[model samples]
Target: MSKATVYFGIILLLAVVIYFSLGSNFHNSTTSDLNFGTFSMKIPRYWKKIEFDGIDSYIGGITNETDSLTFDYGWYSYNLSYENREKQLFATDTINGKIALITKPKEVGNGTLGIYIEEAYKKNRFNFLGKNILDEQIVFEIFKSIRFKDSDTTLNSKSFGFTDKITPYSGRSLFYTHCASCHHRNKNLFGPAFASINELDFKKWIIDTTNLGLTGMAKFGIRYHQKAFKKLLMDNDIEKLIEYSKVST
Candidate 1:
């Protein structure tokens, strides 16, 4: 072969290799749905799903080389009132038709920042930790793609593990609003399961007016939520909740 023709062929071969390499990288990093039985969310296929055991309140999440998306349960009643609220960046966005509260720290550049989604679904919160705020658009896209299964539908393979399929019942709303974050009907979360709790003790723990000086779990429950329980529950309401739990199963 002529020298010019051989050089041209070498250049063509290198170009083809580079093109395929880039294409493979793009395909491996593309987004896909990550299923969690009751819910599914869109995430980059390159990210690894990590199950957190007990790192503070974090339950589980997915992570990559420098980015992570952790999850935890939170209440809507906890309002945002930080001391340096003026310095930080806060914005409201919509997720699946629900309002989501987004917050970030007072960092200038894209360096070791995080996104906190405290409110949107009233029941759960998501934290996206990373180094670049500019790349946060992916997290918002993932959040927007989250879809929850219908209450009546039966879960396959993996499920939320609520007892008896956890089909909708009279006490469901109350449980979801007040107790679901930390307590489940059958599984233990931050607190003991409803099925494992004593009715009388549970009532006493809720109505903690006289148990201010107690210790252990009772004290922790009463002291931490003294104001909340006082504002949320009355004698009649507590009775109704107790009755609901008994028949919910």
Candidate 2:
């Protein structure tokens, strides 16, 4: 055989070996089943799980070397006025037996291309995180794989191993749903941490401050009154939240 033909045969053998090795690796990797209170999903073994803090209904992220997917669940009254501007609607489709609105940005040249899926359920948002790594078809497949778990089997405050000090778990849920995105227990995101407030009558101060706008903070009482403030401002709810804050801080 010619020298060139011999070299080609050797290269083809190496390529076939590499392909089968990769395929075998993928097939042998173990997958993890995640139960996120409201739902459950299977994650590929190659993805690394990222830990999240706070008492969100469900919060989790799984990342591969070049791709990731993160999901968060919270209760927010739907408001058409508060929709994001940077994202443009890409398509609407049924995913996991629920109506989903898929959106993407007009520009995706920054190495990151996010495809957001908003379900009509009004409480959960699933973000497919990657940099042109996961195509639309793959995202849809992942979305379809999501399975809503039975409410009875959902994880609760006790499952998280919280002590009695963080009782009235509803308040923790409320804080997580409404406040956690912007505020952390000890650190700050869009707003100051809950620990920074040093009010003698913190409950009343919380009510007043949240109701009245100050500096960079909008009057949440007015803005989210119908959506969340009314429920959060209830005497019992506020009391529970204050108690939780005291112990958590």
Candidate 3:
């Protein structure tokens, strides 16, 4: 019952509220969960699906349609299977169409659902929350995986869909929030930059470094095992991160 103790309690309560309100990746999302191969990346609630018209390109988007941000997700025998499912995507779009050419096999790591993100007047960049109309669109090709609902057997299922949390984080934003503490834009501070490490060990280093503290630096990550961020971000985030680094470096 001391004054100092009471103030500390209030501060702790505010911190928790901010963490839940702003920090949670599900704060303003709308989906069940994104599927990374067999792994599940939880999506927010209340989000719907996007419906494409079999055309490669999209046009005539205004800056007021919140509903337009959500699109119908489907994949046929070649690319139109899930005419209803919903999911998140990191992509780029043109007036013509998407651009995902999966050359390598799809795995839990390093899987890119290449797609073009079209916006109002072609603003191809990450805008955090889905801004006005196409200014914040996220569309992509399907990752071939096994699903319990789609496949005849439970062996595997390839989930396909669009997402409300479609836009990926910008490189500049990622650097400030995620890497600024221990890393710089050009050189490595605690560990290394995007150009320093390989893709395979990047995630592992993030986990083990936080757990065991590899090298001289201790575990200083912002979102390695966060319940919200972990559920929201896919390996593609890392790839986007790498792409971000190339620009910075």
Best model number under lDDT: 1
TM-scores of the models, in the order given: 0.40, 0.38, 0.26
lDDT of 2 by residue, 55-172 (tens): 7545566677676766555443122222344442243333444333344434442333333334424456455444444354444445545555422222222212212121222455
**What does candidate 1's lDDT look like per residue over 1-249, in tens digits?**
999999999999999999999999898779877876545678887777777664444356777767676655334322334314544455443334333344544554344333344432436554544444456656656655655443212211121121212122224444554565567777788887777777777666777568556453564475566556656666666675677666654
Off by over 4 Å in 3: 1-168, 206-232
Q: Judge candidate 2 at residue 133 and give its lDDT.
A: 45
User: Which pairs clash inside model 1?
Assistant: 112-131
Model 3, clash count?
31
The 0-to-1 C-alpha lDDT of every candidate, in the order given, reads 0.55, 0.50, 0.36
Q: Taking the tens digit of each residue's C-alpha lDDT, what string does model 3 give over 71-142?
A: 222221122122112432332221111222121112222222332222212222111122122222132111
**Sort by lDDT, top down from the best:** 1, 2, 3
Give residue 21's lDDT in candidate 1 (0 to 100). Answer: 100
The weakest ten consecutive residues by lDDT in model 2 span: 155-164
Model 1: ten consecutive residues of lowest lDDT: 152-161
Candidate 1 wrong stretches, greater than 4 Å: 1-25, 53-58, 74-80, 106-137, 150-249
